[model samples]
Target: MPKAYVFTRYGGPETEAFVDVDRPSPGPGQLLVAVHAAGVNPVDWKQRTGYRRPGESDERVFPVVFGNEVSGVVEDIGDGVEGFAVGDAVFGTALAGGYTEYTLVPAAIAAHKPAELSHTAAATLPVAAATAYDGVRQLDLPSGATLLVTGAGGGVGAAAVQIARAFGLRVVGVASEGKKAFVESLGAEHVASGPGWAERARASAPDAVYDLVGGQVLAEAAELLTDRTKLITAGAPEEEVRRLGGARVARARNAAVLEEVARLVLKGDLDPHLTETFPLDRAGDALRTVEEGHARGKTVIEVTR
Candidate 1:
């Protein structure tokens, strides 16, 4: 049996618990991994409260493990899986969940970890970095064009700013005043988030907007882009964004996207910015930091062997 953090049923932290369960076996096209690190994101907490993506109707079987991405070594290969072997270091979107000592990863979305990148850094990529990459590419703004990024201090936002900059686009990053320096360090002009933040961002004369914060913030960002197609969000539902004449970030969840982001990391154009890490026993605290919306960068759970 393996110990995993899980939510017994959808509700709140009270529904969550530590339970011992049989280790997951890889299915067809999947690989069993010995997880070394798991990335914590807002979605992990949101799911505990019954949040699901648009069209996601698969009923959750409790006690569901908690996590979406991880980096680790391969333990076993599933039927029909090729290009990977036992002991190969890998990282990807977890098929089951990632917060346990072992989990399954779909080979289609997983990539080999380069020796230079640490497990902590690779763990943050499949969701946050990959989402950022997709949204930025979706905008397709020209070089020297200004791209305004909302919620620019969190995991995905930080990655978006850097990737946009790497693609030769100028960036305007909106975040709390507390994160101004951190956002600026990512090569974006920091716009303090609050009343009149969008007005202040107008000074940058953005050609596109990459939104990670939904609701009113997204509506405000929408107003800044006259070419609505250039406005994209990983934050809001597609209908909401499309009604505003924008679109949601279309994810290309494949190993190709994972490899591209890894290349960006190796080329010095992106950093996962793993700002905090906790041991497996403290996974709840790590989730809370992101759920509270105060995390300055990516948070990870470092599972010690």
Candidate 2:
């Protein structure tokens, strides 16, 4: 039996626990991975609290693992899988959960981890970086155009700012005052989040807005863009964005997107700096940090340790 940190039911941290279970076998189009590192996102904890995606079902699987993106060695190849080997270093969206020592990945979404990129960094890509890359491309802002990204200090927002800059777009990032330096380091003009952020962004005269913070921010950021087609959000509900004449972040959840993000990392265009790393035993604490919205960039669990 292998040990994994899982939530016994859909609830709070009290529903979570460490349990031993049989190692999962790869299914068709899947690969079993020896987990090395896993990224912690707000969604991980949100799902545990019974939050479901827009199209997701109301299904319950007890003792479910919590992680969504991970990096590790390929241990076994499933039927019909190609371009992957038994020992390949890979990273992708986890099919089961990533808190364990081993998990499964759908080959359609996984990519080979380049030798130059660390597993920890690779783990952060499948979700945050990939989403950022997709949303920026979806916006299709022209060169020299100014792009505004709200929630620009977190994992996905940081990647969005960098990738937008790499593509020749000027970026203005909104985050807490404490993260002004960090956001500016990613090549975006820092706009302190809180009162009057819209006015500060107006001072920059942005052509597009990529929002990672939802609610009223999405509505206000929408006002920044007259075209409305250029406004998108990964954090807000589709209906909310649509109400503002904007749209949700459209995802291309395939291996090609993963490869594109990896290339960006290798080309010095993007970085997934794991500001915090915790051992498997402290997985709960790791989730708490992100769940409480205290994570500056990204936090990951190193299961191999």
Best by lDDT: 1
lDDT of 1 at 28: 95
Screening candidate 1 with a backbone cut-off below 3 angstroms (N, C-alpha, C), the clashing residue pairs are none
For each candidate in the order shown, give its overall lDDT on alpha carbons: 0.93, 0.91
The sequence of per-residue lDDT tens digits that candidate 1 reaches over residues 1-305 is: 88899999999888888999898889999999999999999889988999887778899999999999999999999999999999999999998888999999999999999999999999999999999999999888889999999999999999999999999999999999999999999999999999999899887889999999889999999888788888888888888999999988988899999999999999999989989999999988998899999798899999999
CA shift of 23, model 1, Å: 0.6
**Global lDDT of model 2:** 0.91
lDDT by residue (tens digit), candidate 2, 8-35:
9877889999999899999999999999
Give the clashing pairs for model 2: none
Judged by TM-score, which candidate is best?
1
Runs off by more than 4 Å, candidate 2 = none
What 10-residue stretch in candidate 2 is worst by lDDT?
Answer: 52-61
TM-score of 1: 0.98
